[model samples]
Target: MTATAPRPETSGPPALPPLAAQVERLVALGVLDAAGLDAARVHDAVQAVDAPGLLVVDRGLVPASVLTPLLRLGDRAGFVVEDMTDVDAFAPTDGLDVPPSPVYVVTAPDRGDDLGNWSPEEALPELAARGRSPLLLTEGLHWALQVPEVVERNFCYMTIGSRLRKADGAYDARTPAVWISLGTGRDGRERRGAPKVGWCWWRNRHTWLGFASGVDRLAVPLDG
Candidate 1:
């Protein structure tokens, strides 16, 4: 009889953007608000990124939690979270089983230059135009419960991933539940990072979160 070989075990925790680095990046981009960014907020933001797992825990769609508060703190913040059932207004044409979370739509500033020149006035409308619909507004935790599937579907379609650790010291896979502005532009489009796919687990002890593209691309001020 031939001997069978055993499968090798995967090693190490999944790779993720450093929480502090992410916060710093948000601050540098002027995304962080005056209420101030802190470690707890960073952790919460990270957890919210894993939308799917969060839904499972919370038993529904994930809310805007971290993103909403942060955006609200910023100047000239705008967003909309429309129901998937209202397909006439949203894109892709597919109906979502879950409800929608508040979408942050900020106007891009009309700075003469492209790099870090965005002002509040220019960014708001540009962001809102990307997604126009009746958005639901509520706490992050509540949002997660209302539309778990919708969150998961968006993550899948957008090719985003998430990492989560539970408070009870458990590990679970998560998918991006919310969208945000990714500074990096790619292929005439923007490149954002999330889980690769088919990798969704989480620890009961840790929180979950995910990220997605807020707008197709950074909105540059149109010339009159």
Candidate 2:
């Protein structure tokens, strides 16, 4: 039997860029163009927010389904696994209330590295009791877009806030996650070091996987 290494100190505030620069990064990635949005208008919407966190276009406007592919770390692009082609159908699970705004700020987002190896079943309620919310899949992507280091080796995190509802009305057991690929199995050698968007069973624990969460979410009105 092998022993797992002790967890390191949980990371401090994410290295997110300023609000205005975030918009420019989005523009450079063609996120604004894909959503038929103008850079100036998008910049104006969240200008009033002076906090340090991720600036995300609402999933309604630029669904994670559409934006995940645009995520890049170094020269490696992000991707969803083939088994999850219907990723868009995974909505915010019951009890998660994402605001109805075209844009929002994920206040004080952390990769939750301290929660690594805990199953989603164990992590979700833990987040709630702490007055935090698990980061949605899109939110995780936003973090990677802004600060790629958040998806580092041996320090990845899950996004259990989103789930797919079966026709029988029960939620699917697969919980989404973000991590770096070793380029093994179906992930080709060419994909080594790429940022991976995938899933894990809700009941399973992974030594390298944590539960990503945010202190709170604030709806940043486009009218601002």
Candidate 3:
């Protein structure tokens, strides 16, 4: 009989570390997992339990269930816990209004080809002509949001609510108001788990968002 090649094993999303790590980092420290928790829920959790520090693990983007708890924890702790997801969270009630300015987009130079939906480099030239900066938003997790001062020193984009407004100040149709840069290639290597920048309210699957250095503020309207 001829030898045959063996099939490779398929896999699901990577498994996280043991639950103990979670307990030690969050439950033990008196910190709550605020990223995945909602405000009132977080308040309830805090009131129910006793701890010192909180650690919220976002398996993916920030969800309302997760954010509400963090908000409550922020109220109790006097500071917001770190957001582990690659995107930021915002209040849904807040309105989305683009000031009359130039919009800048940050993206990876190499992976832009694979991003069939959007192109940062191609989009930036016109924006720059209007005096805006096109930054390349990078990929990372919770640690990235920690250095607000550094982010502020580098990028030009701003985070806002998901709802969009028209010229008359009325609500626009509830489209997927946010856009996130998933990555640039078919292999998914360049964009997997990359942080996105967009409105906070559009937390559903279709919405996209990105995270950029705080220093590079956009001068135009970023529809995503």
Which consecutive 10 residues in model 3 have the weakest lDDT in total? 105-114
Candidate 2: which stretches are off by over 4 Å? 1-5, 8-14
Highest lDDT scorer: 2
The TM-scores, one per candidate, come to 0.20, 0.92, 0.20
- The local distance difference test score of model 2 is 0.82
Local distance difference test scores for all models: 0.26, 0.82, 0.26
- Tell me how candidate 1 scores on lDDT: 0.26
Query: How much does candidate 2 score in TM-score?
Result: 0.92
Q: Write the per-residue lDDT of candidate 1 for residues 76-156, one digit (tens) a residue.
A: 231322222221111111221222322221121111111112221232233345452112222222222222232321221
Clashes of 3: 47
Model 1 lDDT, residue 174, Cα: 36
Instruction: Summarize candidate 2's per-residue lDDT along 146-189 as a digit string, tens digits.
Output: 77778877899898888989999998999888888888888788
Give the number of the best model, judged by TM-score.
2
